[model samples]
Target: MLRFAGFELDQRRIELRAPGGEPIRLRPKSFDMLRLFAANAGRVVSKQELMEAIWPNIHVGEDSLFQCIREIRTALGDEGRQLIKVVSGRGYLFDAEVSGDPASFAASAGLSSASEQEGLAQQAGGHAAATVAGPAKKRQFSFGLRSRVAAVIAVLCAVIGFAVAAPMFAPGVVAPENTPTITVMPFVDGGSDPQATSMATNVTDRLADGLAKIDTIRVVTPRSDVTTASLANAPTRPADTDFVVSGELQRSANSWTLEARMTNAATGEVKWTTSVAVDTENTDLALQQSRLAAGVGHELAVRINAVLYPRAGVASPLTGSTKVVVEQALASINQTTRERFTAAQTMLESALANAPDNLDLQVTLSALQTRGIQMNWYSAAESTAAESAARSRLERALQAKPNYLPGLEAYCRFLTATNNFVESLVACAKVLSLDPWNGSALYQLGLTQIQLGRFDDALANFKQADRFDTPAVSRWTWLLGIGWANLLLGHSEEAVPWLQKSIAITPASGRPYMVLAVALQGSGRTDEAKAALAKAMVLRPGSTALNVAPPKRNASPVFLEAGQRFIRTLVELGLPAG
Candidate 1:
């Protein structure tokens, strides 16, 4: 029996039980999945690996896998989604600690072995009380015979129990290989300033600390001066590490840039390189340092994880026009305009026609479609078709390459766009679990929290995202989320600045303007509210107060009511009611 979180998994009985011993019902597939997770606790189990194991040679879709995951989570009361965590693109990780009872009752009680049973029989001949199965009148058997019978019965029971419980030894489970060790070399200071040298040292330590947070990679500090060039030339790493990270911190006129690269220790190949800068002018000194460390650390972590858990890829990578088309398509997604969205969609569709199996193209198109869904760019039927296509494509891509980060991000966005807030909670959390500094995933998490009416939690998430400010392209999203959440909590005055900040970053998105109007109206600024409403109307024409509010389907009652209030306020500001 395996035990975790006060629950028992009975291998012999093929059952799961609560702490009080009530049997928890699980579908056969779910039971198998749970058993697999229990056996490989703390390890990521890929989706393909799982389907192959659970269904064997039978073909299946990802829905079946998700259903099993859902059922397992429900059975384990894993509402927090911590027990069985989705590791973003890597796979599913059973994060819970597990233990098992390997010593059977016979061994613990000292009565199972043949010699022990013989000794028991001999002892029973003199003093052991024994019983025999017989009629009461014929029950007066010799103690030696009764004891011998008892010993035989005990031996038989032990053998039967051992045979029945043998499966708990976990036949298919195997230990994972050791984690890849990463050594963080000291940072080079580019400027002559004494402060720059101190900052570089601090950044080095901070980067190491951040990388250490990732459980998949082991971070080691270099004892002596180390450089990527030196490590590359050496036959062996000083600590026998797998990878080395070397970086230089430079103080610029307006910003501090940290350039870093990771090289394979044995091959001397530079696996990844990045340069990230933090604004020293606008941000506080400490905040700049924090962002500098997080900026580079987040990127390095992604690259390292990609190398460690590479997804299934095509024989040839996207190059030339295909690569440009893909990049352009993704850039257009950031524009947040209806025409740009449609054009980008067309571009991706055409490119995908040539390489239908390209995972990058598939995920990009799905993400663009998901963005359209979020922006209400589709009619009801088109929206349905888009959602279905996005989900199917993403599922297929993820099943093919379960640990791909882009696919995971797109999936989380799809879930949030469809208002699958409950599942979005899990998906977004998984993204953040692997990439803790991801602002986009954090925005999704906060939005889901808002719909669930957890206003304070939503605000906290948005603020946390703001603190990280990663992928600064997604900054406007969390800013808008913060403003919307504050408005939802009736802090209209406090919501105004964040909404304005969002508009300053991406003024084309009418939604932020709509939110600004709401905040202005709530603050009793009628003229300002009308002005904001007019700007929203210009950016998002033909939006009726009735349909301008978010889709009410599947939303919590409190959120739906608040949404209606937002719509009514828009109506008051001359928004069309049709």
Candidate 2:
């Protein structure tokens, strides 16, 4: 008798008990096969050995052996043969522990001692000789006693019910604690709609993004991991991650229902599972989507944190005035050209009034004001006033938090826009020194180098920017910078691929196509270059092909000539003169 994984089995009486105390019936051969496995726990029992133990004289087919194994698995809750794993081409093994008091049962059964059992036949022969009679009569008496002995064995089996029941009462050993790492796999769409798959991928990506914000947890991006494909395969261990989060999405009418499960990757043991439904017919799809994303992110974070760091508390950092101000500022920035600057200024003023010491808001205001000045969209007096106000705010922000990277980067941009390229370069270098992997700092450094006409240095900084785990916008910007720098160096062939990659990553941006046209024209692909320039014009109508403006302070004449030549090629490719 032995018990494991909520199942109890008695070898003596061939009885199986479910977790709820219900008897599970099985075929005779299935019971025998299970008994053999339980008796020799933690050992690999060969098929030939098992056959001889179960049927000493009868010959059985391979299919019969497999059928019996299947029946035993069914009786044990289909632990998927995990408790009794089948080694390919090497028979079966029972990996789990088996416990029972075999000695006590053997004593209670009044069974012969090991030596006596071995000598039973010889002793029986001696007794037959003493009860000698006619030869035929002696033979008949011996045979009758052998039949009676088999009957006695059957009666003794019925009397020892406790032997079969002992394993049922025995407690199971607890498993060891695990340090779990979770990976959320992309969801699968079971419905007929193919767009549902993309929706699922988007949801998974958003969940991963939200989780990545937490400092304690390590989240892998979907682009790098193939967890989604693993879930679709549904192997014994579907994903190679430490813990796998997989789900299915189905559309019903105008809503979507998601069913998800988190399981241990090694054991396939389920830790958590739930179903959530969201109405797709909401008046504002974006708000509904955000709600769903927040719900899932918060719930999963809470669950995982509870298990890993139960005492740690979660804080709502963005709420009240902070949330309101941030939302308004973002909305303002997304407005059309005519209203964007005024709307941004208004929101910034309001946010500043509420959170006077907030460094982020101060820096954002400075950057926005600097952009207005650099674009020459404001009057000279207005631009001067804005630049003065921005410089004052940025200085105050640095005074409050000297190590603020965002403030440092914003101040560098402000200096660069005001034609203080040397100061901007020093500020960007300081940012990089503090945080070597800072993408914005690297981008600022690259832009400063380009303005100073250090084309080679600019190319190196742009490559470093891309090497950082940067956002999509920064990545595109770095690639565009690299393309322009390569064109200046006369490596037009090298510039085309980088420029095309930039375009592929961000097709709506006009900068990559603009640079690509110069590279194409320099490489003498005039027709293609013209096509590229035309596309750029469609994207940015007033953009010029001539580098008419003088290089910023500290720029070299030779590098300036190179840039002008590239611009001339763009003009030949037929871009508009602004």
Candidate 3:
């Protein structure tokens, strides 16, 4: 027996008991997890380590592990979250003092029953008993017949299962034959200034390096400087070229600008183009080259990724009319209003129904639903359905396109919301490594940082997202993040404008307004605070001092304390006590 926190894990009896000696039921997996925790009590258990221990050969999703976590927490009645503590960006820890080598205690409790003792003695004397018995050839023949029949049945079942599931698993087994090929011609320096020439060369180098990291596409970066007009006007393109990427850099007043485009080489038609500017005045010279290159490069990469992996590489970006419907869904991701969310969901569902295998629509809907789950728009049953559908779609999408930024972003957000921060952190970093200016990924990263109590890092991440401001639909999310971080950091006055900007762009989210109320209250505008709170209450009905509070799980003590104070302020301003 091992004892801690008024509970005893009786290994001999294979059960857990509360202080009152009542048995606590647990699923087999949950019991395994609890036993693992008991063995390593008071130690931080990394998620990867835990998964490997619990599931040796199986490649299960984090959801399985998260379910077990929920089970353990419920069984322990760890509402305060003191027992199973989450170490943000790390893993989980079962923090408690446990007794060691309590075999005598199990004996005292009579957990080692007489039947169990007899079974052990029988096992020890089994070989001797077998010698005294006959060979029993009749029994052997009967067992062999059954074994052969079972083997035949198992073989048939395996073949049928493989045939049925091959498509689902094909992405990993088979290499893609239709992988898109892209060529990056060296960017032309549009200005005569030496600074502009240097900027062009740096961006040209970095852009190629960045594109090379994408596994889904084949990138060819030519060394020789090629004029943008040459690639645009030339009749011939490389024989294998599917797309040609060419751009020009110029130094304008106080900023460096990059005008970049991707062209369909075979059709001699322009595919995509964008203009990006990096402020020389605001950014130090050291980081300017990266900003200029990634600004335009990130956009082009997303466009290329969308064309190749129409399964929503970055926020479920689609290519055609389906894209328009998907964009409606993306809107809910940006604004987060309950009505808009439902409407967008209905639209996507209808569109997806028309084309059930549309992987792009699947992931887009998944991403949208993840946002709904984050906003608590789903009931218990609804949340389960939403999470299940989204998880299936995301897993399938990822299996198909591992480098798709949109899918990665969605999965990253899913893991973050599930309190699986360690994997979420890695996912966010992967998105950034693929496209450094990915605003969606940055927003998710900032969220993780906030939960970790790294308020300053979170603020910087949000601010960086604002600066890059790529994929403009996701603009409001980062804006809200910045304000949220500022409020957490106690710079309430500074948080006001950012929060207001976020609300202006996407006024549907009651969360932003509720947070805005905090900023206003902290700024000592009592009347304005009450007004903001009223609007928030109107936006989100049935909110209370209790339910309105953000979850404390995995959030650092500093963040929890700050959140408590913010909740107290909201209550003071008129939030209900329920």
Per-model TM values vs. the true structure: 0.66, 0.43, 0.60
Steric clash pairs (candidate 1):
89-403, 90-403
Q: Which tens-of-lDDT digit does each residue in 225-327 have in candidate 2? A: 4654453445633343566777887878777777887776676677777676777773344333433444455445545644553322222233567667666
For every model shown, the clashing-pair count is: 2, 0, 3
Question: Which of the two, 2 or 3, has more TM-score?
Answer: 3
Per-residue error (Å), model 2, residue 488: 1.2
Best by TM-score: 1
In candidate 3, position 375 carries an lDDT of 80
What are the clashing pairs of model 2?
none
How far off is residue 199 in model 3, in Å?
4.7
lDDT of each: 0.71, 0.57, 0.68
1 or 3, which is superior by TM-score? 1
lDDT of 1 by residue, 270-351 (tens): 8899999888876776567667877887788688767865543553356778789889988878666999999999999998
Measured by TM-score, how close is model 2 to the native structure?
0.43
Worst-scoring 10-residue span by lDDT in model 3: 136-145
